[model samples]
Target chain A: MKFQQSQEMRNLIAAIFVGIFSYFIIKALTDFDIVPGVSYIYNLRGPLIAPNMITVILFDWRGYDTLGEAFILITAVLTTGILFGRGVLGGDVSEKDSTPIRPSTIVQKVFAAPLVFIIVAFGVVITLGGHITPGGGFQGGSVIATAFFLSVVVYGFKKNVFNLSHNSLETLEGVGALIYLCLGLVGLGLSGYYLYNVGADLYPYLGVGDTATRLFSYPDSTNAGIIPYLNIGIALKVLSGFCTIITVLWGAEKK
Target chain B: MNGSEVQFWSFVTAALLMIIGIYAIIFMDNIIKKIIGVMLIGDGVNLVLITEGFKPGGIVPIISEKLYNQSPGIFQEFADQASYSLPFALVLTNIVIGASTLAVLLGITIKLYQHYNSLSVHEIFKEEKI
Candidate 1:
């Protein structure tokens, strides 16, 4: 008993140590700033004021990287699908996740229902406003996916997720990916650059920017005309990719 | 701390977390632990990428009319956007992708557990070979 207690104490100590260390480290870093050495690198201007410099680099300067990233998502989804195969919703396992923790109170369940819906709505709003703000499709989609994941945890398979079925998820994923690819193709046709910017004005249809300036006014001259489309394509593909993973994992077959 | 300090500490925290994550993967026998470690590493890498673009005390690259009030007579064009926004956007996408991959890996772990009835990586490998 003493040994067991000591081991538990050690684990608690370790956890506390790690937590404290992380806090102090972050605090220290945030508190410190260097004198003006790299301001020149940081001072370059782009078409929009972005939350971070990396966004400018990815979409405006090195857009091809973004394209590669989109492809990576495509590759991962394809690989997972191919390896796991379709028709995964049913398998021969006779058991279900039947361990009963304290059953949810009716009041709790009712409260959760509206809470989940509100959270999902928030995710949708974030994704829609991605171009204008810090949140984008991936973050929004993941937030949405989290709601689904959380619902599964709270309500379990037999109660909460019965409506979504496996097939709907697959379809959503496929359509999402196809839309991403189509957006890229549209960019190519409009600006001679794959995944070009067809701004908000081109609503519901893709159109090249009327007056193209070199991206960031840099002489490198890549992605000069295409950036917005890339962002949209990325958002769509990421959302789809995450949702697809959730479906594949949760929707598998069980007897 | 100032901007540079903030950047430095964030980088250090990220690095430490990454190292711990790698160590967990190397030492922990549990598949779940390994997956968690992988996630830590992913997060750390994302932090590094994001930090790489920071110019201490630099502002975000969005343009708004309010900027004229904040820094009167500053170039109107420069106030709106910064050079760093593009890379930041890309990194944001990457962070999302990394998170999804973690979710997928966790799903795989669940499947493995369902098949083997155990979480031990060594045991799973042995069973697979047999």
Candidate 2:
């Protein structure tokens, strides 16, 4: 009875149960024959919208789903802001100053500034080139956010290259979300649907041809339509959302 | 080497990940460890999804300009060789959601630590009048 009541014994029993459950799951999944249809169709038709299949799928085919996912991120950021926003929304009289803090050594400071620029540049490239490349908004946004974290955590939010404030970050997030919403609204206006690929001129309902295409499409080899613009919106939103969360969590004291 | 072999191994890896995650969630006393376990579970499910999209010998789902310029028959061949991309899109969205959620959870954890001055789950849950 004593042994059964112990944490170790509880762990063992839990492990055994999970193992048995997964064993059956694995067997069923392994034996099942998956006949895929939508993916095959998407592979054939995906390039008509964009050369990159995954990007097209995320931004064009299932843009609604992605919108919901983005809302989840935005909501989470707001939740964190609420959790740590003691002086932010309503609290004490606040005056904020950027702190001047040096790294332990001269060599570290010299490298940090230039490296941050390089990282931000790389993230921009990934974000912009997402349509014709492997990356998308999410990956590129996180890459940029990583740079923000490095600089803010190491050099304190007072880096010589850039200064970030909560208000500015919130504005960026709002603009990002507005971009996405407006793009969808344009689709609704043109083709009577949300997030229709107007650049493709693929939809039968979108009777407006060359003129519409010229107005909306990204200046690239293929007509990725609103996808690239959507990528930019998502990247900006994600970058700011993450930055906001970190700033709140860091609980920067006003000097 | 082949489709089934790769699929089976991937499933096994996913199963192992989930089992470890479950154990960590149940056995570990630290809130951070439990959060880590939740992440592991998410990763395991993502692996299973991506593995489902794999083929025996498949290329990336991207179509290059050169391939597009090729004859219609060649383009069709590219389609046949390419892996399913829907799961990849799902995984990408999930990754972003997971990261943001992790940040939120950790922020909450920090506040809890400040209040309780303890990271132990047992201590956090101990009966206290207040």
lDDT of 2 by residue, A102-183 (tens): 4546776677778888999999989998989998887788789888887775677755345878889988998998899888
Instruction: Summing lDDT over every window of 10 consecutive residues in candidate 1 chain A, give the lowest-scoring window.
Output: A215-224
Candidate 1: how close is chain B to the reference, as a TM-score? Answer: 0.78
The CAPRI-style docking tier of model 2 reads medium
Supply DockQ values for each candidate: 0.23, 0.53
Compared with the true structure, the alpha-carbon lDDT of candidate 2 equals 0.80
Candidate 1, which segments miss by more than 4 Å at Cα? Answer: A1-45, A48-64, A77-103, A150-163, A199-237, A251-255, B68-83, B127-130
Lowest lDDT block of 10, candidate 2 chain B: B70-79
Return the lDDT, model 1, position B50: 71
Per-residue lDDT tens digits for candidate 1, residues A78-181, read 55664365424565333243434457777767777677788788887676555445565566666776777666656864566325644566566666656656
iRMS, model 1 (angstroms):
6.9
Candidate 2, DockQ to 2 decimals?
0.53
A162: Cα error in model 2, Å: 2.3
> lDDT by residue for model 1 over B1-130, one digit each (tens)?
9966777777887778776786677667798888888888888877766776566555665434465345543444453233344345556667656765775677677668778888888678873431
